[model samples]
Target: MDVRLLEKEGFAGLFMRLRAEGLADKPLLAALEQTPRTLFVSAAHADAAYQDRLLPIDCGGFAESADLVARLLSLLSLEPGQRFLDVGTGSGFLAAVAARMVERVVTVDRYKTLVQLAQQRFAHLGIGNVIARQADGLKGMSGEGAFDRIIATCAFDSMPRAFVEQLASGGVMLAPILAEDGRARMARLTKIGSRFEREDLFEVPYRPFIPGLAAAL
Candidate 1:
C-alpha cells in the first residue's frame, strides 16, 4: 500500500473507534476525516498525530485529543450556515473542524504564536471561513457579536458571563467547568430567550482557563 494511504487508514480507524464510542457521528466523522490532524501539530509529533491523544504545540498549551474534540462537537449540535465561536484556539484543530461544518468560525486564543500558526494552517487548507485572532478568550469576542454555537477548549471555575451573553437565542455553548476538588465536568448551556439552561454532559480533564492575553509569544 502507498505510505500516505496507510497513514490515512490509520487515522480513519481512530475515527471509527470514536463513532463506536458515541463520541462522533457521521457528519463529525466526515469532517475529521477531511481535516488532517498532522497539520495542526508540531512536525516532531506528526507520527503520533493519528493517536487519540493530546499533543504539545506552540506556547505551553496542548492540542486537545480527537475524542475530547469530537465529544465537544457532538454537544454543540452544529448545523450548516451557523456561525461558531471557538475559544482557546490552541493549535486551531477544533476551529478548522468547525469551519468545515459551519458557515463560519471565529476563533480566539491568548497566545500570539498559536494564533499565527492557526491562521497559516487554515490558509494552507484553503479554509477561508475561519478567522483566527489573538485575544483573551475568557472575555469573549464581543466585537464578533452573537454566535450560533460557542465552544471553549479550556476549563474554568465557572461559566464566563461573556460567553453566556454572546450566545444567540437557541444557541448552545460547551465548556469544561472546574471544581474545587480539581475535577472538571463538561457542561452544556443552551440559551433560551434571556435565560440559559445548563446541563452537565460528562467529566473531562482540561487545562485551566487563563485570563487576559499572554505576555509573550
Candidate 2:
C-alpha cells in the first residue's frame, strides 16, 4: 500500500543502492524490497517503518534495527539449503528474509502474541519454509546439532551452553552478549570441534532475554 514513508525515510532504497554497488547481496536486496516493513509496525508508527531506526511494534519492545539486521546477515554470508535458528523471531522480518535464502528457518520467541503475529505474517506472505514457535530461547532448542546458522535478537548475559552444543561444525552464530555490568555487545561465534571461538563485532542494545527463557536453560 502506502510505502511513501519508506520511500522518504526508509533506507531500503539506499540498501538497494548498496546492492547495486556490490556492497550487499542482490538476493537480500530483493527480499528487503519484497517484504513491507510497514506491515510489521503498529498503525501509529507505520510511517516510521522504512526508516533505518527501530520502531515499536505490538510489544513493549521495538523491532531490530535495519542496519543491524543487514549487517548481521552480511557477516553471516548465508547460503541456500542451510538450517537456521532465529532466537527472537520478533515481527518475523528476519525470518521472512531468511526463508527466501535458506532451506529451513526455525525461529522462536517467548511472547505468544508476537509469535501469533509472525505466523499471520508468514501466512500472508506465503512463506512456507520458516517455522515460528513460542518458546524460551535461553534454554536452547532440543534439536540435532549441525545447524548451519544461529541468530539471537535478544541480549544474553552469557553465551548459552546449549546453543553452542547445537551448532553444527563450522556453523556461525550471531548474538548480542551482555557484559558483567549489563552492557550489550554483538559477537559472532563459530563452532570448531568441541569449542566455540568468538569475535567481538561492536556495541549494541537489545531487550533482555525472555524471563523463562533463561530459567529453562
Candidate 3:
C-alpha cells in the first residue's frame, strides 16, 4: 500500500468510530470529512488532530476535540441554506466544519490572532461563506441577528440573553451551559413563539467564553 493511502485509511478508521457511536448524521459527517482537521491546529499537534482530546491553540486557548465537536454538531439539526453563528472561534475548527454544512457562518473570537489564523485556514480550504471577526461575542456580531442557528464553542452559566434573542423564530442553538457545580453541560435551545425551550444535552469540559478581546496578544 502507498504510504499516503495508509495514512488516509488510518484517519478514516478513527472517524469511523464516531459512526459506530451514533454521531453519523450524513451532512455533518460529510462536513467533517471535507475539512482537514490538521489545517486548524499547529503542526506539532497535527498528528493528534483525529483523536478525541482538546488541542492547545494560539492565544493560550484550546480547541474542542474533533470527537466532541462532531458529537455536538450531530445533535444540531443542521440544514442547507441556514445562516449559522459560531461564538468563541478559538481555532476556527468548528466554524470551518460548519461552513461546509450550512449556507453561511459568521464566527467570532476575542483574540485577533485567532481570527486571523482561522481566516487563513478558511481561505486555504477555499471556504468563502465564513465571516470571522474579533469580538466579545456576549452580544454576538452587531446587525447579524436573527440567525437560523447559533452555536457557542465556550460555556455560559445561562444562554446569553442576546444570543437567544438573536435566534430566528423556530431556530435552534447548541451551547454549553454551566451546572451549579461549575461543570459545563451541553444545552440545546429552540426558539418558539418568542420563548426558548431548553434541553440540557450532556456534560463537557469546554472553556468559558472570555469576555474581552486581547489588548496586546
- CA lDDT of every candidate: 0.84, 0.78, 0.83
Worst 10 residues of 1 by lDDT: 1-10
lDDT of 2 by residue, 99-124 (tens): 88889999998887888899999999
Better by lDDT, candidate 2 or 1: 1
Which is superior by TM-score, 2 or 3? 3
Locate the minimum summed-lDDT window of 10 residues in model 2: 208-217
Cα TM-score per model: 0.93, 0.88, 0.93
* lDDT per residue as tens, model 1, 1-217: 4446645976777778786886747788788888888788776877777777778888988887877787789778888999999998988889988888999999999999999999999999999999999898887799787899998888888866667779888999887899888888888888988877889888776878878989978
Model 2 TM-score (2 dp): 0.88
Give lDDT: candidate 3, residue 153: 73
What candidate 2 gets wrong by more than 4 Å, as runs, is 4-12, 16-22, 213-217
- The better candidate by lDDT, 2 or 3, is 3
C-alpha RMSD of each candidate structure in angstroms: 1.8, 3.3, 2.0
Top candidate, metric lDDT: 1
User: How high a TM-score does candidate 1 get?
Assistant: 0.93
